[model samples]
Target: MKFLIVEDEESLRKSIAQYLAAAGNICDWASNYDQAYQKISIYSYDCILLDLTLPDGDGILLLKYLKKLNKNDGVLVISARNSLNQKIEGLSLGADDYLIKPFHLSELYARIMAIVRRRNYNGNNVVKYNELEIDTSNKEVKVNERLVYLTKKEFDLLLYFVSNKNKVISKSAAVEHIWGDDADMADSLDFIYTHIKNVRKKLTEAGCKEYFHSVYGVGYKFTDR
Candidate 1:
């Protein structure tokens, strides 16, 4: 999954990014409110790690903006403040979960996954679409009871397609979803096409029906029909 870390503390931010990346997630970091605002305005994420306080502006404003825009990006507020009212406010403002600072990174990962599962997969860790079964917890995919090997990127792409089945997802969005902020530096979107092709080949070889359709001059869509 893709995540945005809205944190000012350089060490903690880097730590969170490294941890999530190691877990096969794409991460983007923003040190202050303005940077956070810009990222949220442009890109979407599976979840966002928001710190309640910032040097320039309050983090609550960002929450309000997301609510105003009606974006479904899950939010997990990570703040040092332990006040009851602050937690209440953050939750009331649409934060999926809240974590007090000085907490374990493992706990943070667990919470983020819980939120994403709840919001996206309706609280199910294992996502099933027809004959395709994805055990997200174990990062395993099976088609018709046959294990299908996929690279991390290929697995992520397949999961993404399943999450938004039937929607025409542009190559740029796929690139951003997989590479996070690094997508901007990419010279072209040829890698996106390559990953999708590999995923299709693997699934088809595993006896799965073709669900991916390339839309000329646009992008691709995953649909049963």
Candidate 2:
């Protein structure tokens, strides 16, 4: 899963990012509220680890702004404050969970998985679409009981398609979601076509029916034939 870690503490932020990366998660760091705001406005994350105290502004205010924007991004508030009021307030402001400072990295990982499961898969560890199954915990994909090999980007792209099945996804949206804001430097979306082509080829070779459809002038959609 993709995550954004918002914390002013350099050591803590790096620690969280490294630990989560080791566990097969893509993590981005934001040192302060402004950075966090910029990241949030530009990209969509599976989950966000928010530090209540930042160099520029209160994390609670950011939480409020996220809610105001109607962004349903899952959030976990990681703060030094352990007061009942703070916890209650954070939850009320739309945080999915809270983690106090000085906590174990393992616990943080568990909390993130829990929140992601609840938010994306309805607390299920696996995401299934027709004959295909995605083991989120193991980052494995299977089609018709046979394991399908996939690169990280391919897996992420497939998951995104599955999650938004039947919806048209523009090339720009696919690039931004899979490659982030840096995709603007690319000369064209030919690379995106390449990725989609490979993903479709792999799935087809695995004896699966075509579920990914190119929308010609528009984009692509995942739909069962």
Candidate 3:
């Protein structure tokens, strides 16, 4: 998953980003309202960790923008505000969930996963196709009841392909999804082919059917037919 951390406190922001990154999620950070605005306006994220107060303005304004565009990206508001009205307004404005400050990072992880599952997968923590299964909660993939050990990138890759099955995913998009802001610094999309090749080989070796197909000029598609 790709997450955008909208926070003003440098230490906390880095801490949160680091924790999520360690958990195998790509993360991007924005320190103030304008920075956050620019990121949300341009990039897509699986979730956003929004702080209610910022150096420039209230974070609710960001929520308002998301509502104006009718964006369904999961939002887990991280705020120090304990007022009832504040929490109420955040949720009413489209935040999927709210976490008070000084909370555990583990709890935040759980909440983010819950919201992602609810919004993106209809509350499904497990996703499967035929004998291939993904336990999102554990970040594990299985084929024919046998465990498939995949590197973090490979696991993320498999989830991306499974989620968008039957659709052609461009290499650039896939790169951005996996690497987040670092994708901009990348010289080329060639590295993606290597990862795809590895994933293809692993699944094939695990007794899975060929579901990933390469599109000559565009990118690749994962489909059953």
- Per-residue alpha-carbon lDDT of candidate 3 for residues 8-35, written as tens digits (9 for 90 to 100): 9999999998999888889999999999
The true-versus-predicted C-alpha distance at residue 54 of model 3, in Å, is: 1.0
Better lDDT candidate (2, 3):
3
Backbone clash count for every predicted candidate, in the order shown = 0, 0, 0
Return the clash pairs for model 2, or none: none
Cα error, residue 190 of model 1, in Å, equals: 2.5
Q: Give Cα distance to truth, residue 52, candidate 2, Å.
A: 0.9
Off by over 4 Å in 1: none
Q: Estimate each model's TM-score.
A: 0.97, 0.93, 0.92
Give the clashing residue pairs of candidate 1, or none.
none
Worst 10-residue stretch by lDDT in candidate 2? 175-184
Task: Give the whole-model CA lDDT for all candidates, comma-separated.
Answer: 0.94, 0.89, 0.91
lDDT of 1 by residue, 85-114 (tens): 999999999999889999999999999999
- What is the descending TM-score order? 1, 2, 3
User: How does residue 13 of candidate 2 score in lDDT?
Assistant: 90
Tell me the deviation in Å of residue 116 in model 3: 1.8
